[model samples]
Target: MTENLKVEVVGLNRVKGKHLVAQIRLSNTGTEKHLSWAGEMADRTRPLGEIKWASGIGVLDAQARTWLLPYKPAGSPCLCSDRERDGLGQFINPGQSINVYAVLPAPSGNPATAIVVTPLAPPMLNVPISDEAPAGDFPDPDAEPVTLVNRRLILPAEALDKSEETADDGKDLQVNLSSDVLFAVGKADLTASANSIMARTARLIDASASTTVTVAGHADSSGNDAINEPLSLRRAQAVERALSALLTRSEISFQTQGYGSRRPLYSNDSDEGKRRNRRVTVTFAKPAPATREPVATTPPSVTGLTGTSKAEGQPIAMEIAGLRRLPGGLGLLTYEITNQGSAEARFAELHHAQDWEAYKYQAASNVRVTDVAAGRQYLPGRLEVPTDDGVDSYCACTDVSGIRINTEKFAPSQTREFFNLIALPETPGTLKVKIGPFRELDVPVQ
Candidate 1:
């Protein structure tokens, strides 16, 4: 019965932006009444600050268990606020038997250690309370129990670092992609364009000579779990087949699972939210070392820039890189951009083929960039070219240059721009476009 004093993490739920909440249950199997008990949350992989008495229930009915203690844990400050700790609550009881709960907020690092739930101490009554009891007379409180539950909650795209080591052991890699890329309204079939995009991903896996690929499917909460789970699984399988054909490497293995509506990317109460929850992910497993040449890596060059005009009057810039030549005299370029000025900017337009030839005019699109932190780096954005007959005109791009520097509330300083200009095979060295206060630099098509 002493084994019941042990605590276990019974459930883990991940919230948006890398925040997580864990439900822990502690039971008292000892025959003697306990005066007090406390537990601490610790991580071996990384430093986890004290959670204190996150949550706990004092009383226990002999073999009885206390209520679950729920705790919030996150991977970054950008994901949530440190002030969230203020909303946390605690509970405590003594004697008979009880269960306890805790809320733990994680720090901004990907922790690799197991979360340990350790008991603080048994009851020590100073006023000769009825709950205090001798250790040996009651059951040994430190005994380990077999039915305890301990599980970890990992965020999507959070397991990439462990991919290589766990690839061959059937270990799992959990990734959550923006649902916007994987599904259409109420549809399970893979979009032809989506297939095309994932084809490149499959080629990468094949090039790595991976042994197996696992695709996990997920859906939003628009429907019941019964319907969403099977649907998600089907979506996963569909991706596996498409990827298999694209890579044309049959030696690689595959598996698919459906998580159903149990896990959602966003709140499904809104259409936009539901759309963000439908997604399928692909994880690759590396094969044993073999006599195969390493995949070739070529640094991509900057080719061209897709230009646009903004009504906001704020200066805008785009940086392009990873330029490569395509079949039809077309070029490809990818680059990173940033808003260096005080004002916000966005992707406003692109020059299409017909528009390019007819009026030497640029077709316009609307995109906005905001949340310009004083100093912070962001992921790079990509752009492709040879204009897709106006079909694939818009691509989301991020602002990443710091050319604009000014203290004035309305005026912007010098706005630096970056762009990869893709052009026809014979198009001179490079083309340049000046829209608003930003200069668009196009590189020679490689």
Candidate 2:
């Protein structure tokens, strides 16, 4: 064993996407001797069995026998199956020293303390990065820059299939639940109806035995920020507590955050819109294992909408979802409308482009409808001229009389469904589909 060979951690940093970086230095105490050291880094705050090797190279010194190394840290219960573990492989010549550096993902608020630097012969001297000085003072112009091999391990949302299966790999998996299942009217507390839904979520974590879980709560724009922010957080924490109780595994970790109206699933102008915006989502990640290769899978689906309404005396709103591509070159766009205030909402006027003041509609254009229920789909008898370029395109409805269509008494929770055939413009870019006065759905027509 080389008595002069000493290992020290000099710097550490936490990065976005839950990654950690550490810089280390190895030095020789003897005046004329060489040494070599190698080991793995572990975080005690995380699951004990979930540690992996980091990216980057090992450093060595030929004279004064010193070295510096850098390494990335990994979370626990790695999901990637394709990673490899290579122990230290080098020898230090007399009077030489070296340094090493690394980067990895770790739990928030918890620092890593399981770094074991072995000299192969006892007298191991591995010091934390905080206790050491900066290595920048010693410049080595001729030293070759260490190249980092950037590799990512992605875990699919469906990977948590077994009860005892824990995701210790440093891979990320995200799943979003429908807003309809997350909240009740004007309330932040979890509804009794949502207990089963939360139970399923708890099972997901328990099955995966994840090292960490982050739950983010969000609300619609129906209320002011002051009332919504804390409400969102409380909702998130509620879910967190539910999951914690269901998952009895003490090794599992958790975190909670609230975004309030900052992130909305839908606009808050209508009751249905507000219902779709209140939601809580949980994201889980596991520490990666050494000597494992990551598997490949398709990306998850994302859904959202953008809305705009015409300047008609009454408010107009539209909500659309399940926006997916069709077999032919044509795309499918579906939406629902609602009349909240006490007023008759005539679809016929909407068909003639009277509600919209921005875009001009050509007279006598053939706007065909493929499907419509009795009395629900009505057309305004008169045709209106297009006023500007921003007005939403209009389609002909069968009914012409401006009668009260869907809502009888202008109740607060009235809803109507409408379908339109949109011949996508020849141009490329995002197509903004206006639903009503307060809601619009933006679909990308690539």
Candidate 3:
């Protein structure tokens, strides 16, 4: 809820088999005050100077594992409601209602329903899809919106699966080799242990569609650029030379550079951050999307048992409220948390400490969903936001601010629902959901 605002989908219908026009109703349900939503729902990436628009509202195809942003033409803002032109002004007064709409790309496979994703509300699940053309005038009309809907799908990375040393963002794959693991201290010479690592890296590059690969070296902020730059470049050159010999592909080209102390992935204030900053990164394009269409699977709903746990020695009860399939190989896990103690309970350990800086106090980042059949575990979905230095990753699921009412801690006897958007593999049967301090539960895929 965006400050006592209740949203309802009026219609989510196809327009000439190309675009989905989402018609939504925003009601100020509060009796006391007027609600000002100065484009709170706009996508932060390209918000068009925050003039109040619904560009952020998108359709989350969980099965397809894609979020379709509002449709934008070659030289126009998004095909969504614009408060300035629509005369919607700024506020929704007490007991007033207004309508807004966004035109988005139709989900591939033309499923019967989609999950409507909003910035500050819970995912609106299983909204029925109609194939009919939109009725009445649009909030932002275009002469030929349907014809322009053929815009290519340049989607952001569908998922970012990160390991201890690698991060794959669906499009580009990066393998980060720690400088300490590959070289002698203050020198560019490869250690004896680097041979096996280089061999493994050659195989990864061999499997990609990349015609050019970049091997970039970095250094921590401890040293001045004069000392760090040349050393970093030497380290990159060594790695490049080793890869040149190891790679079997004859046409592959290597581009190497060293950014000494200029681009740090983590804050340079900590020991772990300094260690991570000292590294060589090999980056290449991932293989193209498979020609074969994505498998269509109906989302399943399964019941899970109530589980109990203690956080900070304070008793809390938890249970799976709902588990449903989302498009784009995703799962929407809804769970409930009840503070059973006499005092307010803070489930402080339930979040990923590393995510605090990007998503302050995210409540569900630590939740894991395991595909029982495939024996694969997935963390909550994440999106990487690029900064001046490097990329910062944050969970794609709901955070603590959206789940809690007034504070980070849960009041005694207060029960609130939490959601986690999980990256799931195409597996049948049950999935095991794990939350810290609570017993894992087997939830059937629906």
Tens-digit lDDT string for candidate 1 (1-446): 01234455543333332323444455544554542333232211112233233332111111111111222223231111122343322322332333333323322232322222222222111111112221222111122221211122211111122111111111233344434565565567776557545765575576565677778888877668888888888788877777877886667788789998776544566765565456776676422223434333553345445443342565444444434433222233333334445665443343221111111112211111111221111111112122335211111121111111121112233332222212222332433323223454444434
TM-score of each: 0.32, 0.29, 0.70
Candidate 2 lDDT (Cα, 0 to 1): 0.40
lDDT of 3 by residue, 278-348 (tens): 98988998544334344447545454467897766778988887777554445677777788998887776
- Tell me the whole-model lDDT of each prediction, alpha carbons only: 0.37, 0.40, 0.70
* Runs with alpha carbons beyond 4 Å of true place in candidate 1: 1-202, 241-251, 262-273, 285-446
- In terms of lDDT, the best-performing candidate is 3
Reference-based TM-score, model 1: 0.32
TM-score of candidate 3 relative to the true fold: 0.70
- As for lDDT, the candidate ahead, 1 or 2, is 2
Best by TM-score: 3
